[model samples]
Target chain A: MNDHSTPILASQGTPCLLVDEERMERNIARLRDRLRAAEVAFRPHLKTAKSWEVSRLLMTTPQGPATVSTLREAEELAAHGVKDITYAVGISPDKLTRVQKLRAGGIALTILLDSVEQALAVAKASDPKDPIPVLIELDCDGHRSGVKPQDATLLAAIAQALAPRARLEGVLTHAGESYEARGSEALSAAAEQERAAAVMAAETLRAKGWPCPVVSVGSTPTAFSAQSYAGVTEVRAGVFVFFDLVQAGIGICTQDDIALSVLTTVIGHQREKGWTIVDAGWTALSCDRGTATQNVDQGYGLVCDLEGRPITNLIVTIVNQEHGIVAARQGTPRSDQEFPIGTRLRILPSHACATATQHDRYHVIGAGQSDVTAVWPRFTGW
Target chain B: MNDHSTPILASQGTPCLLVDEERMERNIARLRDRLRAAEVAFRPHLKTAKSWEVSRLLMTTPQGPATVSTLREAEELAAHGVKDITYAVGISPDKLTRVQKLRAGGIALTILLDSVEQALAVAKASDPKDPIPVLIELDCDGHRSGVKPQDATLLAAIAQALAPRARLEGVLTHAGESYEARGSEALSAAAEQERAAAVMAAETLRAKGWPCPVVSVGSTPTAFSAQSYAGVTEVRAGVFVFFDLVQAGIGICTQDDIALSVLTTVIGHQREKGWTIVDAGWTALSCDRGTATQNVDQGYGLVCDLEGRPITNLIVTIVNQEHGIVAARQGTPRSDQEFPIGTRLRILPSHACATATQHDRYHVIGAGQSDVTAVWPRFTGW
Candidate 1:
């Protein structure tokens, strides 16, 4: 193994995910500090930076709980000593055995349930002596799954079904529609709606004498935009640890704040089209046009220099499975001379979660240095 | 270890890739038979199904060569006894060392070079006694990389730069623009252009007495649409093993020919919005919206039943990192009851290359059986 103190990039291969350690730390600190200031417990979602190294730095509370999208992530984190984890996606009956295994391993695992059928499935699958803990999913923005917060009848039925073998923990809401927000005002509105919906669901459950202890609400946009987290016990958000072009486009964070980028090398060029072909294609950068609906359409991703400075007027125009076409934004002269074969560059992703999933590990560049200081493996698949 | 003859999917978890053995074999046979009829050597590109099992079945010539996008793939295939492998991507100076290592391992590795700079870099890196074999990449259609085939001066200059340290082996071109072809007429036109351009480049090289021994031309659409391969020696195409929605939309293959799909389970639903939430999201299915530009806009992917039959009017409308929203197409009535919680479904991807990269292994379903007979691992990364 290479020395951790050595510059990591110097010994690394191209077309690898590069996490700026300082920027990532700063991004984590900003969110943690903000949530702390709001006096709400923060559960950093592990769905974005699926790395133990990054998760270690993200922990504000020692051995604290977190949110995960898949059981695989929960199992990995649990093996690494993370105690509490909420499998954020709605529960499927088939996964009950795996969840039981995770719980048996001493993980304080909580599952998400929105329907009575799911609650019954979990209750039936659970051991009566060791009841499974679950949070009721509330639909805040109707962007995806979940029961509406106002559907008290359905919520009560689900709670009743989980009585002996499962425990009704609280309610969770994700303002995924907040991603469609065009401005701060819209984002703030969506945040408030998300907060209100989760708080309302918790209140309705408590009014009915149900123990709704934890009211969770958040999304990366709402986590930063919410004016208050009043009745919520914990806020959950991912992607802020590595701000992407989508977040930057919506003014969630500046382009400079993006901590994750793909380190690539210029391999060839198409002179007539004024395109500089790079090794980081859709396979490396990902085919996430997250910013396409935003104010500025970052075709594939924003082009940056080796040091992560934005190359003005340059963007990845098109991409194949293994080839990225970098060219001027519009009406700008080509700079083929500036980016000859073997020239290294960094590409800020349109969506951090999408782009990061394409790679197996990250070549972490420490603050104020081009060398890779560390390498962190990330797990993928369900 | 699990028995290879056992039903693989019966014990496997959800949200995993499922490859239909029969369809895949038939697809492979069709391509090989067509190429054989055309009298051109078939060299399948391993960028799609990066599984050694698939490559084994793809070999028309015993222990024959294939094309790869990355050196890592070349190395892996070489280890598995694929002798004459071609690293299809344009060469970078840094990769020359790895190429040399592969060559030393008795693999007749051919690298791609489109510039004089790359030629000189290879020549400088190679040992005088064992020159590196290279193919000059020609720009047939201004879709991506390569030097224009008509530019004989630049080609001659590159050949001169190689000298004794590097050998100019042949010429190759991929009509990636064939992806834009909407109908048979357009596809046939693109194929002709692809064939004509590649042959012209080979003829140009041979006219200059450069001993151009090989001429390769292909793309999935062109491979099937081309009327003749006249002067081409070999044809290369990936994505044929697992046809996808994009290929179907381009009229290359019917949806029935698609062999790869994601096995998912319905976790929850939004009744009012007519949406059924699935466990497979962008992470499992990939974020490739390849069919978005085609005549049919398959949102994330086309939703199919457990038997891999298309569920009429049902499509994955949106996707989160680990959740997919399955809904009815426009003008179709909602059918949430038809797809309840825990109901297993198959999702046909928009692009096989993009989708296959998301999974670590394939759950191989045998011919005419829903049960999986084998599990094959696929490798990824540059």
Candidate 2:
């Protein structure tokens, strides 16, 4: 951890995002391998690593069966020749125009909805020649948006509403509550609940003489913990590409598996308060205290050495816009001798997706080396 | 509050940032008038609205006496012909090259430092012919960074380090802790402490026969609440250009004064749970739960109507990466009839600075009108 001679990061600006490519590829491969072994299609969510360069690695093919949170991501991926994509968030009427545009451009873009109102809107927007493929989102664990799996009336109503104008491609559900799962047992249970909910909905649609070809169910924790995909055609997970403290806390990935880190310099110090102020604050690191609810709360982010190894007991305790106060986790004394002014350090993020979006580009550290291999551009906004 | 006929926002995509120009102008004028009446120079921090268009309105002149947190802000403002800028964050050694580059390009760019290590780095990086004008940062309260006003030895040491190579321009301090102040009395006390610390530090340097010309002190709360600026050469404040919920909670600005909002579309609803899901989740509306500690926690943000009026008792309670769960505060029942699918709602930010950085562009509602007159682009990163 004391070996701070990172030539690539040393030359770069103090507050910048660094992606360990070796670790990133390993993380991506781990999830891909798991899903491949499970004999299910892996539709990797591009929301985490919003780079085409990263997306190319995550996708099974250039023309993807990918998942996206935003239409911007769908558009960007489509531009990169990704043809098959699922717009994962609930479809709003206003957003359907962009979805239709993407679909018209020969991208097999899919939209998700859980209500009859949304179904009717999708039906209204669809072309007679090429009806829009839709997914009925099911609420697995009362997490967020979705129709209940057992709501047969609502399920039949939504499918019937979409009948002639739109195509009911499948049913999808996300186990967002799986983030709260502590152990493998809890995670497995959450995954099963998600899978069962998704499959049940798909069955209901099929039983009612409706097309429900795809059964998608996932979340980073649940995807890894799922004992079986069962009837699910494809599995989707976003944060698995760059596992963070939240996923690490969920016991999915360890701190070492976290590919993203903010490269920062020790700007100044408050020796009396044992605070080593760094140039990277909430602006660079993001205000995601995802680990606060976990067993070991990583204040803002866990502090690491330049080589991307954790500095024992050190974390970002406080943050202003551009100033992060790095201190020992348990009020232990830290000194200038350990982290003096101009000392380069890396901070492992609390939430990878949140932190990754803060930066425009990623300085990718070469496979198993300290040298920066390449810089990948990231885009944001709706 | 019920008027939802906004042609501009309706045509535009959901989850875009909207800046009320009339309210913004008023917010900016309030601070400018206050500082001007106090007979002190105002160096408005361009960190809040990082747009050249916005900066032009905030600046007193084309060649600005502006404040910036990052070198990127300084560089961008410089490109817009801003000459006099103070980079307020503590200078890191690696960042000095860029600082020097800016100074060499005819920018009277001032860098701040609180330690001898930084002063030495500044001194080393300084061109003996045109030394970097440096400010010795003083910690007014036990806030973030700075040399303590009472720590004369360290102050003298820093000044001594900059003696021949770097020019000691002045002293600066920001009462970042002022945001924690509740009422006018507490705000005034925080302001006085910030002013006293800067003046006291300037006096200490002067007593040692060192030139300390520019004694700058301010924070949004302190800038407005400070009764006197007797010894201070200039006052610097950001976040006043677009007041937020946090500022409202601090009693510095009323909720009516806030200018920034996130325009989101109601995508779906969890009716039984009284949750209205919106497209603007943490990704669009930042993961900044800044109002959580306030007396009345505004969750993610306070929900407003399309015409930028607050909806009674509504707040965004939970957020996923791309979905926000807006519910009535205190778990009051909110039906789909109240907020149907495709209903465009504007969310007032919890922290303007944090929320504004989440987007790249602002859809500006023209002065006292609903139409978006212009689109202002915002830049971010180190």
The top-ranked prediction according to DockQ is: 2
Measured against the true two-chain complex, the DockQ scores of the candidates, in the order shown, are 0.79, 0.88
lDDT of 2 by residue, A254-360 (tens): 88899899989889888888789999888998899999999999988999887777988899989889999999887555634458888888999999999998999
* A-chain TM-score of every model: 0.96, 0.97
| Candidate 2 Cα errors over 4 Å, as ranges | A1-6, A331-337, B1-4, B331-337
| lDDT score of residue B232 within candidate 2 | 93
Name the regions of candidate 1 deviating beyond 4 angstroms: A1-11, A331-337, B1-11, B331-337
Worst 10 residues of 2 chain A by lDDT: A1-10
Candidate 2 lDDT, tens digit per residue, B32-129? 88878888999999999899999999998989999999999999999989999999999988888899999989999999999998888889888899
* List of clashing residue pairs for candidate 1: A7-A371, A7-A372, A8-A371, A8-A372, A9-A371, A9-A372, B8-B372
Q: State the lDDT of candidate 1 residue by residue for A148-217, as single tens digits.
A: 9999998899999998789989999999999888788999999999999999989999999998999999
Error of 2 at B61 (Å): 0.8
